[model samples]
Target: MNQIVTFGEVIMRLSPERNKKFIQSNRLEFYFGGTEVNVGISIANFGGEVKHISCISDDFVGDTAISYLRKFGVDTSSTVRSKLPLGIYFLEVGAVMRPNSISYNRSHSSFSEIKPEMVDWNASLKNCKWFHWTGITPALCEGGYHTLKEGLVLAKKKGIEVSADPTYRSGLWKYGADPKETLSDLLNYSTIFIGGVNEMNEVLGSDYGDSNEDFIEAGKLLLKKFPSIKKIFDKIRTPINASWHKIRSRMWNGDEFRETTDFDITHIVDRIGTGDAYAAGLIYGLLNFDDFKAMEFGAAASALKHTYEGDVNFSSVNEVMNILEGNTSGRFNR
Candidate 1:
């Protein structure tokens, strides 16, 4: 059994050529990505025993996804295969003054239609110490919602620590009930919560501005509302351009506030899925180190994600430790 288990959908991402819109691109790049799956891949790359639990289509695309995850040493024995088609999305990477856009075509995907009995919860998470999920799972469909609830219940009963990322996607939840009600119900079972202020406001029905003060107040209010939650990890971002960004993060760990300095990244190969990488890094640090060290490790991991092309972070544990030790000189190998 692995130490970590993550559950979510896996989709094949098709992104347009550089500096081109979806309509103008003659060819697109293909990669397999999902929030939870990305986190699992990152953890596995850092030598963590990670298992991914999700439904995949019994097709070539599904096989490709499984292979991609296995390349990073992730365990996929608990994954199920169904007859439904795999989900896909088209991404348009922004340039200059433009912003990136994603158009998903994933209705009735095998993972979205997953039910409670489809997964062997007891065996899959028997020796797991940490179980992870995201808001997108419950927003998939009513069946997905029940399945996620069942997984959470089983994980709690088995004494596994659970973490959740409230990555609220408005379009994904259109087929189901309101995101607010659904996410609130799930948060009750979550031990660690990760999201931005905008997402928190959307899911928790709060009308707050985007300022440091607002976020601190919101964090205090949220902790009071959700007593089971022990920590809130917030990723802060500042866009310098389409190809550059400045990133930092802060954590509200029940008793004290901790933050890391901004990391200025000059080249961004792919901006998508960095948040998931940060979450995975934070989870690793929290499991192994103290609170302050965890925040620095997580921020450094997120900074490293900008240099990679795909969504899954490919940096090693040594690289992350070096960055956490304040070696940002970027010296090449001797």
Candidate 2:
């Protein structure tokens, strides 16, 4: 396999120690993460060659973030430095009936200041087989949108596969871009759609329910509108509470629809990057397995992420394969 390239901001996450609210803790622990980088790191853990592109502050904080990605085997050579500060978010981990909360302070951060000239996409995308992007990048700044669009257009020309995760957050779209229009336009360049009914409805302005039938219809309509999309994969989560959840994945590959069994996660350690884990697993599986098996791999990877702490899923390929093989006993491996 060639390189997998991810484009997005690297955010600094500050959280109060284990299950404690901000008010209850005197100090905060920090970790580096973002949706795209999280996926990159997870793929790297699975032994994929991944290159991450982004702008970080020209300071120690940015240095630490680069070191963090390097520690996870992600290539950060394309990551650039800016005089702006690094983006930061505060997360409040929840338990049982409680819920996690987040506050962002990233508007003026280094990533938001990214320009198209900052990254030489032609060189960064060299030897790249797959490119991954999320809607959060475009929502940040106009420059981000243009930069990603430049890469997408080139990726299409180069015959590279593109995965689009349109994680539309209304709050993040404060930069004056039409969320629906922006996402719809980007979808034209994407080869795989990585979202569910809600994202579909948001981008298409359709009122689709959560039933399987509704999902199938929405997916078909999506492919009809965006002819470039070859398949659709969605990760469905049934959250019982902050501590436990059930996850499954479904897919529509042009002619057939496939779904996976639920992987129940009890006593969740962290829920931050479960979706990223699913995306990473899907990418890896698609590169090596059939569509149905890839969807199952994605669901299992998502279930495994809840067992680990922080924003990146550090679970190896064997760990994810164990879940696929029905070895969820959390047994000690000596």
- The number of the candidate with the highest lDDT is 2
TM-score of candidate 1 against the unseen true structure: 0.95
lDDT of 2 by residue, 1-334 (tens): 3999999999999999999999999999999999999999999999999999999999999999999999988999988999999999999998999899999999999998899999898899988999999988999999999999999999999999999999978999887889999999899999999999999999889999998899999999999999999999999999898899999999887688888889988889999999999999999999999898899988999999888889999989888898899998878999
Off by over 4 Å in 1: none
Model 2 lDDT-worst window of ten: 252-261
Instruction: Write out the backbone clash pairs for model 2.
Output: none
CA lDDT, every model vs. true structure: 0.84, 0.93
lDDT of 2 at 103: 97
